[model samples]
Target: MAERSSTMKTPLNKALAQRRSKRRYSRRSCGEGTYLGYTSGRQTVLKIPTSRKKPKSRDITNQVDPDQVALLVKKEWHLSYVTPLYQFRYTMLKTYSKELSAFLVSEKQQGQTIETGQELCFKVNISVVLGLAETNQDAETIYIQILSKQVFAAKDEAQKVVWSGLLTCINGDVDYLRSLPPEFVSLPLLCTSGPESLSALVKSWLKKTFDCCFGPICITSTNLQWLAALWTGCHPTKNIQYLKLAWTIPTQPPMDVTYKVNPQDVWKLWDSARLDDGAEDSINIEEVNSFIRGLQTHFFRHFRLDLSAGSLMRVSTALGSAHHSGKIKITSPDYMTTVLQLLTECALLKMPI
Candidate 1:
């Protein structure tokens, strides 16, 4: 009887193993040749980019206030995607500033006593950042800064800016902007550099005021690859100093690999990857892939491990650094527009119909 029971259990275990193997194969087969596209309640699929133009260095110091530009490039900002703001107008910025200030003050004071010399006071300022819009359909960029001070501070003491945010659309998709109603403004991207609590409070106020929704936008590994290629392509005109990439490999305990390449060597590889007929101003997806492959191949020759098997977690150069978690630091102002355009595309992709 014991021998017969053992025989019966062996066949049952075998059947379960076979079923698991079949499921794994099916999942792999389905992932292949899949044409994934973004849909926003439209029958037509959005044509996402497979390639992008090389970033051209443009001196924006003369275009806007130098002080404002300094403030932007100095901080690493947290990113968010904002839906179309219903009835948002550029004319009422002053009124919006006052209202936002009051809203934040009321929120802070709730269920708390205001003690003399102990309570904090808040001030909000909103202004238009001119000359960022490329097309007429694009809305003028709005800059917001929140200043805070102690309620009993000295009269000569100045309030310090505790938070700052930018709402802008630079070279946005024309069709999507045109499709929106006149009342809706397509400032789809928001970059905030501040405490999480203040960021949440400001977002809440904007949502209540403009009937818009905000969602966190994370930079994906593929986008980081694109950024690495784009920034590397700018090496000729701009000094990238060095190229550094971070990858995470799935191992028993997870492994991290940091690969750093000399700027001159990587530039030569990028230049060689370009076709003879390829325009000097633009780079194709094929060239980008080749550049990356060249790096991975070189590393494999020495390490006997393929870096491509791991996920790219971060990419950094002298000009900027981008992480997969959506935090970015722009050290140079020349390529700010290019970065903002890519971020805008990502934000728009997050929009729900």
Candidate 2:
């Protein structure tokens, strides 16, 4: 059997050798920087040297950090890609900062909200479980009726917010974010639901943007670490480091994702009475605020967070502290006071603005 097998291999080797002898070996083709034409319907190729190619096609550029850019651009991008709202917020800075700082949040009171405040009330809705129930008003209304605080500090502190209100604001943005190709949503902090179709659409966009903005080697083939980070950020649980592993590569043969944040984990975090530490921490407040500032800087920025009056009060504290710390400053204190009043006014109104 061995002799016969060896004899057969000799014929196969001879056949392969004959084929290789007849074929021509060619060098790598300079297919790029070449133009095509036709002569008498016959195709012709005009090879342009690589040096002749347009510089713009080869010369890479980067996007602005997005932090320093005017808010108008951010707001435009948000509306075109993120959301649609009735009124936009215009800030009045009270202090100043080299980077981040105090914005005099100014707006008029929603008189309609105060007038119709009597109409707002909580009522029972649906029974999801044998014991657990969803109030009808709770399910539909954007916010539960709340009174105006005489003081601004009380307004910025986050209290209980209606799920409906969250839905109204985040839902549209979520849908828009989902609808967009992955590239659009691939901005560092902006993550998507862990749906393959969603991420696949945007992944290339992210790769290109980061590559173009940062550098070609910004994301190479071994970007599992990047994906791992994104996976945790997008997962409903808001647990960016949910998958624990030694942050190394190759030697350990970085294993496949073995653990996933469960649905229960997300519910526990998102369905809390107040802001969970995980939620607060998961969201980079400083970064997000910077992005928010970007939104307001140029185009009108509208963010209808449920925090409303009370939450705004606490925000005012940060705005003030950051203001004093040289993190932020307000050029218009009157405007700042007015903006603060307007935010409280909206909260008292329970209006989704």
Q: Write the per-residue lDDT of candidate 1 for residues 242-272, one digit (tens) a residue.
A: 8888888776677788888788777776666
lDDT of each prediction vs. the true structure?
A: 0.72, 0.19
Clashing pairs in 1: none
Error of 1 at 215 (Å): 1.0
Off by over 4 Å in 1: 1-56, 111-119
| Candidate 2 weakest ten by summed lDDT | 1-10
User: Pick by TM-score: which candidate is best?
Assistant: 1
In the range 1-353, model 2's lDDT, one tens digit per residue, is: 01000001111111111111111122112121212110100011111111111111111112222222121111101000111221211121111110110010111122222221222221211111110102221111111111222233353654321111011121111222344443321111121222222223233332332331211111111122222222223334222223221111122433221112233332222222111232232222222222222212211112231111111100111112111111112221212222222112112122111
Q: Relative to the unseen true structure, what is the C-alpha lDDT of residue 139 in candidate 1, on a scale of 0 to 100? A: 87
